[model samples]
Target: MAIGDSVKPAAFQYHAPQSVEEAVQLLGMFASDDGRIIAGGQSLIPTMALRMARPSHLIDINGVGELEKLSVSDSVLSIGACIRHAAFHRPVVGNPLGGLLSFVVKHIAHYPIRMRGTFCGSLAHADPSSEWALTAVTLGATMIAESLRGRRELHADEFFVSIMATNLAEDELLVETRFSLLTPGTRFGFYEFSRRAGDYAVAMALVTFELVGGLIADVRVGVGGAEDRPRRLPEAEKVLTGHPPSARLFEDAAAAAAAAVDPMEDQQADAAYRRDLVAVVTRRALERAAA
Candidate 1:
């Protein structure tokens, strides 16, 4: 049988490639013909099932062993495309970044979803409410996109374009993401508001900062689910940096976050409600970090 002949195809063809080079070649051939790369399929499968996405070919990358790499090297945590969310249940490295990932991974839907969903897949999906995406933007992670053409590295700020969208080209696959390990004694916090336990977040915040001489330094505040994409809040960071952690300062930072964002409005939440949620989540995250 040919590569995709076994599966009874209604409209799409499936190809499983065992190596990264093979997959890239297939993508180069089929991307213009609506070929998509499937890893964990946490989001893509459902969309296909509902007939929302009608790709003619799916190049499954789960069999690509090279894409399953997860390691810490050169003071950075590198997560490969096939590394599932469950891998982060325990600290993957002996650093604050590992602990922070462990804490945030639990909020990524329920247990079963975590078992199959890949970290790189989440970033590729680019959901605004995704916990991993928020963490990536907040931590200044670098995304590596590969293809038959070439390889390119993108910072989190430039990688994500909007909800369920990214700057990745049609023929490119997200191969790996590198997150710099947090320094020792760094403080971090994350909080989100959702309608139910496993529902997508309505609004969320991830905050990190270091203290020097009892004053905050290197502060980063990221807000998500309230905007088109997860992004660091410079206005909020400005309020927190160089200041001692206090309830008043946290409140001010939260206010700045709320003021800075132009929130998304939908059936679940109006713009004003989302703005309020931004303030609440931002304040709560900052409080948790300070504590």
Candidate 2:
């Protein structure tokens, strides 16, 4: 037990599954009690210690090294369930995903937390304010999940249903998430506001754009921490795509983004304040991408 953490988790059986097949079988067997999968344990352990989560069996998949797969195939990136955030922070030359990953990983938490945290763990956790989750939504990433029954793929929009919620089945393990590489001319910008460094963002904006003949050929805007789920701001994107970039247009798009999501009041910030932050970040992100 760590010092100052006196609260103990409820006693539970543990299973270290060595293969995806074995993991799914155990997951299916424990569906009655709702088995919990632990990947870095950054979120799971805390929830368990708080007595907020008590699973009959804890399935630790770290032993299944196949889940640690990380490779670039055909210029697209496929990140496995067990790949640590620290691996994504490494310097890689001429890789767009690596560049974006490094930027996002730096904002996740402290170095030790990054060292231990898995990218897929955060994706499965489905935290609305997670930088990775926000980026996944912006990238329109694909999720691969496997169960004893079979395997299925999910798009980012289809996977995240709400805050702390996902389409992942109880008996399925998230195997990998695939991300498309941005084209050569793509311009991107990511920004967020938190009370302090390493703290969860109160409001965040991620933008990507491609210019053709001095007009926006493609554009995407994703807002996080202000609503129940990460989402692309279609209204905002509509304002930019096929139009020439302008400060006035960006201002309008920012307003559209603030209107796109219904943020709720919380101790961290009120609905009105979050909406204002959303506008500010969205405008800045769009401007940055245009620049």
Candidate 3:
């Protein structure tokens, strides 16, 4: 076969479901047939083009009107599966979470990719360098999955397993994801390092905390791309809690984060380099949050 023919995706049947129940039913039917769901098609399309993923059936959920819902209620922001990353370009609500999302969303790929990529799709993709995945883990977001079996909720800690993998079952669809709003007085800071402007982050950090009586409280420090999965660094958070926001304290927290992670290494970066980046990004994010 020619190289061009080898790169092309295999023939597959397409199914467009207009409702959540219908989608779940189709998924159940095709679960054993290597069926896959397609949303923004940002990540999957590229893989498909290279013949890395050739599902026998492709389930399209964009036509489902109910899945496009985006709302803030009961102190939580609910993002549907069809909600694009571009949706967060503006503050979706009057809360700090919206602003934080707006700030981070700009770091995802390029303008065209943002217009077509969905927020939940990023989480479902589960790339270690994904900005949205780091944000979701930092905020302790909840993932809602639906299938013919039933509906279930998975916390951020439980949702992500490893690089490009999640707890999502073969027949389950990620219907929605919800994030608890950052309360008043909560400050957020985020920083990432990459080779180029639109490239995936080699290491990134997100920090959120509230100041009580001039001391840090409710601190959350999340590190991504440096490890197999993005996660909260309790060691770093512990270093920050009850401390005043000072350069010394931030550096201490950054050091704690650097020590805590078993950094991932690839052709572009070594383990030592990734760990150093974790320290740098963590400190920068803490500085921004404290600003």
Q: Pick the candidate with the highest TM-score.
A: 3
Worst 10 residues of 3 by lDDT: 1-10
For each candidate, give its TM-score against the true structure: 0.96, 0.95, 0.98
Give the distance in Å from residue 126's predicted Cα in candidate 1 to where it truly belongs. 0.5
Arrange candidates by lDDT, highest first: which order?
Answer: 3, 1, 2
Per-residue alpha-carbon lDDT of model 2 for 13-120, expressed as tens digits?
A: 999999989988988888668788888988788888898998888999999988988887787788899998888787433655667677778888778888988999
Residue 246 lDDT (model 2): 95
Deviating ranges (above 4 Å) for candidate 3:
1-6
Report how far off residue 79 is in candidate 1 (Å): 0.3
lDDT of 1: 0.94
Q: Pick the candidate with the highest lDDT.
A: 3
Q: Judged by TM-score relative to the true structure, which candidate is superior, 2 or 3?
A: 3
Point out the higher-scoring one by lDDT: 1 or 2: 1
**Candidate 3 local lDDT, 1-291, one digit each (tens):** 775566587889999999999999999999889999999999999999878999999999999999899999999999999999999999999999989999999999999999998999899999999999999999999999999999999999999999999999999999999999899889999999999998999999999999999999999999999998999999999999998999999999999999999999998799999999999999999999988
Instruction: Residues 213-285, candidate 1: write the lDDT tens digits.
Output: 9999999999989998999999999999899999999999999999999999998899999999999999999
Residue 128, model 3: Cα distance from true site in angstroms: 0.8
